[model samples]
Target: MLRPGPVEQTATATAVSVGHLHQVFRDAYGCGPARAFELIRLARAALALQRNHLSLAEVAAEFGFSSPYHLSRRFAATYRTPPGAFRRTQPAADAMWPVRQAGLLPLAHLLP
Candidate 1:
């Protein structure tokens, strides 16, 4: 049997329609589920950039990004710095703190 995706599972668990779930997610997060999920993924990518010796392409692939360029675009948009620069400058241990300060940690509970 096919298992429901996260949004469908969330809707079922919360006893709400998928549309309602989307609306609720937007109201709470100021973005739809997809955008929120993207942000969460980017936040994790940020940590990986800081903490790992992986190349940008590797980091991008590991985080489900299409490519290093795509990762750079999203990372720059969200964190105001390219992933390469971030990786070079950020301390590994402090990676997630900046993300937390930027309000990305609210959805961290949804992370695997």
Candidate 2:
């Protein structure tokens, strides 16, 4: 048997149905749990790019992405730039501060 994924586990832990969990996430974060998780993952990947010298494949593997190409696709879709370009241009100190300081709710903030 397969173990429950994070959203399902969260619903169980919180004593709510998965549907209710999704609803609550949507109400609080303007997106469902899956999307929130994705955003959090992407944000972390971006930070890794800024603060490390890991190759794209290493970064992708560390962050649970299937491959460097997959990471690039998602990163480009979200940030409008590829991971290599982001690493080259972004200052480590400013990796995510601007977005957070601008009042965008970081998905990780919703976690314990």
lDDT of 1 at 60: 82
lDDT computed for candidate 1: 0.73
TM-score of each: 0.75, 0.79
Q: Model 1, range 84-109, lDDT digits (tens) per residue?
A: 88877766545555446546576666
Per-residue alpha-carbon lDDT of candidate 2 for residues 1-112, written as tens digits (9 for 90 to 100): 1112588888998899999999987777677777666666677788888888989898888777888899899888878878888888766545554336333455456543
The TM-score measured for candidate 2 stands at: 0.79
Q: What is the lDDT for 73 in model 1? A: 97
TM-score for candidate 1, please give it.
0.75
Q: Report how far off residue 105 is in candidate 1 (Å).
A: 2.7
Tell me the deviation in Å of residue 54 in model 2.
Answer: 0.3
- Which stretches of model 1 miss by more than 4 angstroms? 1-15, 92-94, 97-106
How accurate locally is residue 28 in candidate 1, as Cα lDDT from 0 to 100?
74
